[model samples]
Target: MDMNAYLSMFIDESNDHLQSLNENLLRLESEPEELSIVQTIFRSAHTLKGMSATMGYEDLAALTHEMENVLDLVRNSKLKMDSFIFDTLFKGLDALETMVQDIVGGGTGKADVTAIVTSLQLILKSDYSAGKAAQPPLEAAVTTVDGSTSASGGMLLDEFQSSILLQSIEAGLHVYHVHVTIRNNCLLKAVRAYMVFEVLERNGEVIKSVPSVQDIEQEKFDFTFSVFTISGLTQEELQGQLLNISEIEAIVVTALDSETLAVLSNAPAAAAAEAVEATVESSAVKPKAEIAREAAPRKGQAAPAPANVSRTIRVDIERLDMLMNLFSELLIDRVRLEQLSSEIKRSDLTETVEHMTRVSSDLQSIVLKLRMVPVDSVFNRFPRMIRDLAKSLDKKIELVITGADTELDRTVIDEIGDPLVHLLRNSVDHGIETVEERIAAGKPETGTIYLRAYHSGNHVFIEVEEDGRGIHHERVLKTAIKNGVVTEEQAKQLSPDEINMLIFAAGFSTADKISDISGRGVGLDVVKSKITSLGGNVTIDSAFGRGTKFSVQLPLTLSIISAMLIKLGSEKYAIPLSSIVETGILRKEQIINVHGNRMIEFRNGIIPLISLSKVLDSPDFNENDEDETEIVVVRKGEKWAAVMVDEFIGQSEIVLKSLGKYLTNIETISGATILGDGYVALIVDPNSLIK
Candidate 1:
């Protein structure tokens, strides 16, 4: 069968299961006696093994299989679980994840898991005696069922009895028979047949085959076969089903004698009831295990019963982009309709328009929500990362995550993970001190790093904080001066916040010694650039002896944004509402020039001013002496800047469209949007404008 279709699902599910295993394994290390955790690990491993096997990735399958054996022993309480074991298991899971990722990336999914496999084997070997002892009784019970004396008599019933057996089978009742055939090459046929009879179950359950189902699977039965089935299918169908199986040449069906009938009837009832109860118990005992095993590969394990089945369909980003663009057009039309409704003032028509407005608004919301995803999707891998970092640094650190469930646009989520990883590594390698240093500094033995996210207004904020040595402002300033990122005079006039922002200066690192984690060269400048590329801002706050925090604020969605539309010259431009502090009209005389730069006195403070036309490289025009310029004040960090515009066009939400890949180096214009008049207006990038 072509397995490509299942590969995507297998990879997705395998990653999810592996992530769960990683997290739960950490918890298990702390609470080793938690059987539920062990069972969960077992289930994930088992599922991964089955998926790998089905995908024909034998290396992955073999690794997960070995991991499953170890987890099974842990679940059954035969092996002691501890931190060492948990760490080893986590490592194995990580390897398994890597292998799956390899397959997802179109590789062979092969990796050297020899070390992990050996470690697990050693764990099993350490408790081999106990495991062997416990397994023997179950093995013996199964063996007796395949080797017994009375199985031959049950198998030898004649054609007339076989016909009656077929009649009973067609009535939807279970038939039980024992089939015993000596192995084709066996020297003692009689003894082998008797051995098979010894284990014949007296239960009314169809032995189905004289040698038993287990024997059939093992291919232990020879030329002849016996079976009792209560299937509603005709004897010909039953015979054909058996005949279709490989390596089986001859077959016979038999009926029960009077005593055997009594035994069969009573035995099947009790056994059937017991089987039902056991199944329920097994399901309850290890629900995850059962799901994992059923989800594993077998010829006929029954298709998963569909109940409230939700499915995920992979959509191309381009499709969503196109959908967003089309919705933007509809939004513009809706705005036009509202304007037309107001102008005409027809009551009935206005009412219909109002209803359409509400419906369109709801549709817009649904489309936007479809693009919203939890921040946790990006945050999930960080804990494992922090764990590894702390261990390598010889530091005791606790990572605290809050508001991981906070939602953001898919575009932002996709771009945020790498910057967050860089920030976290910075915290571990530079922000947090070693365990001994922390203790000596009157701090707790373990350093604490906090990752928090929350939504406020139309923006979402994510913060990474470390309770370690805070950034030194003077050190940052000195570094900025040395790197020519800031003039000495500029450094002197900088506030503490401004000085701290200097860390984002390219090639700036305060670390005295270079190391793999952070100090070698690249700094927070890259982080800021990445966040700004997604229409977000990054800020740093620190207190000298306490700690440091890096906060990133991003718009809820990138495609469509609430913007303050303003006209500059003959062209309308959009300033994202999230970045606007306030807008007001300013007289030309109120604008002052301080040190050759235009400044406006607003809210009792002098704010720097920039001309929108000049920033956008538009044609210069003579100032209208009698007209008051519209001053839109924007804030980045704690500093305020104002841009003079031709007129205030009012605020409205608009969809942002990219200028396409070919239009490179378009400074200050982040994107373009369609207006109600069906004209494209540029959306300004305030960061680029101010810089």
Candidate 2:
């Protein structure tokens, strides 16, 4: 009966329902006639409302219940979908998400959602049936805004401004009434307003400003400002531009044509008569949130459940980590026992050790799988994000995701989400072109962004590719030179691929204007550093007019890996088997000197040869005078290298241990591992050596 005991469960379920609502609402917006999607959204909202009420989160429940009322009307065919309804619902979802996040951060799940609740109330009471048959060609057949009185120019236009907007609408251009809010903590309100106006002026003309452009520039307005503007850009594109400016909290853009504009100007007079009756009716009908609270079981009472519910239990990730650590110790002891059994040559002990090895190997597989989470957990949220970005950019982007089932270590998955988000946002904002540009270039109107993941060798590769405007080497070089990222002379000597790599330089950006999504010059650099910290690398490929692709290579698991243990003179070393191609002997005659660097031939190709003894400064033995030196051919992506070692001690499954924070000076050594003989062997990072 204690709510604290169920808090985690409530938070998790709330997030799940919220994600479902977001995805389904997007789906419903696209397929408005598809009532099944509405049903799905309704169920998620209903369940969330019930859960919130039961958990004593009345604010969360009330907002959801209001949303459910509008949705209920839509599902029953009493109301139809439109831009206004969609926008309002999306706003409700956003508010719900904020409240839930607040709760997750140990605050009460409460928000000042009076504005959103009022919008939902208007949608519930307004009579759209009058305009149903003769609704003008507006995005929203039924439209309204948030304010105290319906007459307030939240988007209300005067005679002249409305006339100009009407003329623009007739010319097939879009007109929007944007309500912009600056962040409460923003230091320079006037500066933020100026930037917003600059973005608006660049895209379209501002027909009217509520506080007047002069007042806004003088910082006389509060954190919020409203503007009526007309431009050829779609609502999404204009909104996207305004959102790019820093210190702006949120913006609601309502699309208006002559009819919607007229409705706005006259909505107050038309709806005044129904106000008293609607208010009475609204109070008469109880919201689902209150009903849910009333229906909730009393303390110590068991709630009934339907038969055949899926049986599952949530386990904390820390517990799994503890389990893995315990198993690692058992594995090390098992390896030691195997060595002892082989050395003693005892039949009983050998048989028991062999049996133990088989059982332990199976256990190892299970333990690893337990820590393996599908990349889908990260990929699922992307579609909704892409939908929003595509809207803001006024570009048609279809995100084609493949290999969502691909799995990675939990730690890797946790860290990979942010980088992938940056890459995906970069693809949408910069990689893809607008609808007009695509048509001008004779390409499909809708751009396709391919997000794929797959296993290559022992690593997982996640690629973000877009079939829009690709990277322009000349433009990149020019920007690189202008930003002082590279000297003009150095820029001239760089290849196209290298020039493209310059985009990842710290504080590097090619965007003409910064937006909320990417262009602050902090995206790809952070991505590169974070991926590298996880022992991974990222690469880029592009074709000038075709598109761009970013490939990220990451390890499958950070713990326990199959490694080839070799002796570097008297010191022991471990080379991850994932990095090695094959092992063989290289004679002194086979070694080739290329530009003062040791090189060797393998598989009809040549590669650099590195001496482990010299690289690690090992003093016990040197292979310089040896007749034939044992060698291992390793690779990083397409690059190959041959490593010379004194002896191969066979391959073994080893547990990787970090070399501690103080030992970071060794770039070529990734980590250390314990050998069967209880020796600490340093692991060589093949990727670092390939270059």
Candidate 3:
């Protein structure tokens, strides 16, 4: 059989399982007594093992199998959890992730995990330490029932699985317990089982399976198996789907009530392990569809089925990008149509154009949402990273994350990982003090680092702050002066924030010497450059001996957005509505000069005034000497700017188009947009213009 067809799916699922293991293992480390956590880790590993084996990655499968054995022992109370065992399992997980990554990079998922395998073996063989012999206090009863687990392949649901079923029931979904028996003399039992799964999977998500998926694939079961599934299909419909897969078998589907599910969920370990054995007496055969109707509710009535199985599916990001591009072209034409309709003042044309505008607005929202993903996907990896780094540095630090559920563009999420990693590693290496130093400083033994993300208007802000030995101002200034990043006179004139930002300059380092981790004058500069290239800005704030914060302001890029189109001395430009506070007329006399910079006062705050024409070097800017100048007030975080323009063109939806590589590095202009008259207008990046 061809395995190539399944390779991509295998890789995606393997990565998912690996991430699950990492997350659950970290939880287990914190709560070793929580066997429930161990159960989750075990199930993820078990699933990965089956997938890897099916993909012919014996090394990955074998490693997972051994790790599963250890987890089984720990979860069952036959062995105890310890730092040693946790470290070994972590090693196994690391190896598994590496192998999966290799597969993603177009290599066989093979690795020399012999050392990991040996460590797992040793852990399994070693006797439980005397002090750690007993199971967790709450799990004592569960551990006692472990040895009496039934051999019959039964659908045993844990708390996690039970909650899913209960939630499905609440949502008006059907939870079915299906018992399927194969023929006594049936050949290729595995293939038949696969067919049955394919049917059920098409109808619903199988929450739990008897004989375990791996055992069924290995044909370790006698004949019959059971499954617990959640679906929007009625018993008749679901049974029909399953019965289409041919095999000599008897099947029964029981719709479970919440009461019965609760009883089974709280059942003792023994009853929960109830099994289904394959045996043949004698019975007349019937049509598959007939057997299906027999699965109808015994109560003579049924609740409504769910709408359908989930309407969601994984879509490649490239597909979304293509969709956005196509929508951009459609949007341009839509604007053109609206403009023509307005010109002609015809009812039919205007009405049709109005309808198109409404429909396209809804479509535009959906297309933009498709590219937004939760930052949690990126934040989830940091705990494990911090654990390893803290252990290596022999320091005690805790990572506190907030607003992880905040969403950002997938493009930003993909590129932001490495820069965040650099910032985090720097915090651990340079920002946080040693244990002894922390103790002597009248602070807790462990330091705290806050990694947070939040949305404000059109931008998402990410702040990495550490409460430890802050950036040394005198030292950084000396380093900046020595490195030629700033003159000695320039250093004297810099503000505290400006001096803090000096760390992001190319080839600037304050470290007395180079270290393996950070302080090589490399990471921060790269971070600044990468973020800037993404139409974002990074700023640092610090105080002596207190803490430091690096705040990154990022854009929410999409094809279509509402903008205030303006004329810049005969040339048109666009300003995103999200960034604009208000537009008004500012007389030339209202502007003030402060240190050779034009400034204006609005809402009791003084902010800089920037001339759009002067910034863009427009030839027509100086030709007119109007007494009053039109200005748009825009803000980036707390900093505000009044951008001068020639005229306001009112608000309209514009399609954002990127400036290709040849026009890259045009700092003030972030992107281009198409106007109703079919002319291209540069979108001014107000965040870049301010300071």
- Distance from true location, Cα of 84 in model 1, Å: 2.3
**Tens digits of per-residue lDDT for model 1, 66-135:** 7777776666556787666777887888898889889878998999999999998887777542555454
Whole-structure CA lDDT of model 1: 0.69
Ranking by lDDT: 3, 2, 1
Structural RMSD, model 3: 6.9
**What's model 2's TM-score?**
0.66
Cα deviation at 597, candidate 2, in Å, is 14
lDDT accuracy of residue 487 in candidate 2: 99
Which parts of model 1 have CA positions greater than 4 angstroms off? 127-308, 346-352, 477-493, 520-523, 561-653, 657-674, 677-691
What root-mean-square deviation over C-alphas does model 2 reach? 17.2
TM-score of each: 0.65, 0.66, 0.77
Q: In candidate 2, what are the lDDT values of residues 1-691, reduced to their tens digit?
A: 5899989998998999998998898888789999768767876786677667667898998899899888877765668989889988988999999999999999999999999999999987787433445544433222222221223223344555566678888888888877777878988786677667656755667766656554565467778776777776786566655665777776667676566667645544224224322433343233324434655679999965533255978778899899989988898998899899999999999999999999999998888888899999999889988988998888999999999999999999999999999999999998899999999999999999999998654578899999978888888888889989999989879988898889999988877888888872458999999998887789899997899999998877557878898997778899989789999998999888889988887778888998877878888878987999999888866788888899999988889888876786677787898877888989888766765
Best candidate (score: lDDT) = 3
> What are the RMSDs of all candidates, in order?
12.9, 17.2, 6.9
Q: Where does the lowest 10-residue lDDT sum fall in candidate 1?
A: 137-146
Q: Which residue pairs show backbone clashes in model 3?
A: none
Best by TM-score: 3
